[model samples]
Target: MSELIIGVLGLQGAVSEHIKQIEATHCKGIIVKKPEQLHDIDGLILPGGESTTMRKLIDRYGFLEPLKQFSLQQKPIFGTCAGMVLVAKDLTDSDDVHLKLMDVRVKRNAFGRQKESFEATLQIKGFESPYTAVFIRAPYIETAGDQVAVLATYENKIVAAKQDHILVSAFHPELTSDTRFMKLFVDMVKKSKEIAAY
Candidate 1:
C-alpha cells in the first residue's frame, strides 16, 4: 500500500551499507531500530552483522514479536551474512539464538574469523556479472530444507538461497558496489506487488 518502504534492521553491523544499496534501487529505505519502526514497510532487508548482538537488541527492544509478525506477512526479505543466520529455521547447534525465519541451518563464522575474511568472485545463478561477494567473519549455511532453493554456492556449499518470498545470502552482497544481488531482491519486491495486484 505505502510506496515500498523497505527497512534495514539497524541494531548491529553493516546497517548503513544495506541502506545505501537499497537506495541505489530507488526504493525508500527506513532504519528499523525498534519495534515501532516495523510498520507499513513493503519489505525488509536484514543486514550482515553480529547475530548474537542483534538478537539481544531484538529482545531488549521488545521487537521479537512484532518483527516476526511483520516477516510472516510474506513481505519480501533479503538477508545477508548474519542476516542469513537470523532468518534461518534453526540454530540448534550454534551458541547464538536467532529469529529463525528461513528454513535453514547456518554456522556462525563457519568460514573463518576476522583475519580469515576474504573476497571471492561468485558465479551466482540468475545473475549477469560474476558477483563479488565479501565474506567477513561470515556464517556458512550448512543445511537447506526442501523449501529452500539454492541460489549460489561456494566451495561446494550453499551460500545463497531463497525460500518462498525470503531471500538469504551467506555473504555480504551490500559491502561491494555490485548491485546485482540487491537488484534481484528489489525485483522480488516488484514481483510481490504484481502478485498482490492480481
Candidate 2:
C-alpha cells in the first residue's frame, strides 16, 4: 500500500499534536488551511479547539462547503474534542452546527469548565484494552442515530463513536503518546483509498 496523506484542519486547535500523531502512524501529515488542500489528502482530522472560534475561521476561509463535500466523497474524517462538536448533526442548546456530517447530537462542555479537566482510562470498542482519554471542557454525545456506532462512554455519556468514514472522540487523543486512535484513522484512510482505486 502507498503512504497515506492526512490533513489536519489548521484553522484553530491542537494542530501540531495531531500532526505528530499522524506522523507516528507512518503517514504524511499536512496542515490544511485552504479548501484546495483537502483534495491532496486521503483523510482529514478536526482537532480540539474552541468550536465557535473555529467555526468563524472556517467560514472566513470558505471551508464549510468544501469540508461537507470532502465527507460526501467518502474520505475518512476523524474529529476530536471540539472537532466532535464540529461534526455532530445536532447541538443540545444551540441550532448552529458546523459540519453536520456525523449522525450524533452533542452537548458542548458537557464535562464542565477548564478547571474540571482530567484524564481517565477508557475501554473503547474494538480496542484490546483501555485507552487514556483526556477531557478538557469536553462535549458528550447526547444521542446518536441508528447509523452511529458508540465506541466509548464516560459516566454513561457517549464520548467516542464512528459512522462509516466519520469518527469522533470527545477527548484529546493527541495529548497522549498513544497512537492507537490515530492509527485507527490511518487504517480507515487506507481502506478508503483502496476502495477508490478499484
Candidate 3:
C-alpha cells in the first residue's frame, strides 16, 4: 500500500499533536490552512480545540464548503473533542452548528470545565482491551442515528461514534501514547482511497 497523507485542519486546536500521532502510524500528516491543501489529502482530522473559534476560523478561511464537499465525497474524517461538536447535526449546549456532517447530537462541555477533566480506560467496540481516553472539557454524543455505530462510552455517556467515513470522539485520543485510534483512521483512509480508485 502507498503512504497515506492525512490533513489536519490547522485553524485552531491540537493540530501538531494529531500530526505527531499520524506520523507515528507511518503516514504523512500535513497541516491544512487553505482550501487548496484539501485536494492532496486522503483523509482529514479536525482536532480538539474551542469549537466556536474553530468554526469561525473555518468560515473566515473559506473551509466550510470545501469540508462539506469532502464529506459528501465520503472520504474519511475523524473529529475529536470540539471537532466532534462541530460536525454534529445538533448541539445541546449552543445554537451554533457548523459542519452538520455527522448523524449525532452532541452536548458541548457535557463533562464540565477544564478543572473537571480527567482520564479513563474505555472499552471501545471491536477492541479486546480497553483504551485510555483523555477528556478535557469534552462533550458527549447525546444521540446517534441508526446508521451511526457507537464505539465507546464512559459512565453511560456516548463518547465515540462512527457513521460511514466519519468518526468522532468526545475525548482527545492524540493526547495519549496510544496509536490505535490513529491507526484506525489510517485504515479508514486506506480503505477510502481504495474505494475511490475503483
Model 1 global lDDT (CA atoms, 0 to 1) = 0.82
Return the TM-score for each candidate structure: 0.92, 0.98, 0.97
TM-score of 1: 0.92
Q: Tell me the whole-model lDDT of each prediction, alpha carbons only.
A: 0.82, 0.93, 0.92
lDDT of 1 at 77: 84
| lDDT for predicted candidate 3 compared with the true structure | 0.92
Candidate 2: count of backbone clashes, pairs at least 3 residues apart or interchain? 0
Off by over 4 Å in 1: none
On lDDT, the candidate that comes out on top is 2
Clashing residue pairs for model 3: none
Model 3 alpha-carbon miss at residue 35, Å: 0.7
Model 3 residue 61 CA deviation (Å) reads 0.6
Q: For candidate 1, lDDT tens digit of each residue in 20-113?
A: 9889888888888877777767788888878878888878889888878877877788888878888887774665556778888887788765
Better of 2 and 3 by lDDT: 2
lDDT string, candidate 3, 38-106, tens digits: 999999999999999998899899999999999998999999998999899998867788899988889
Question: Model 2 compared with the native: what TM-score?
Answer: 0.98
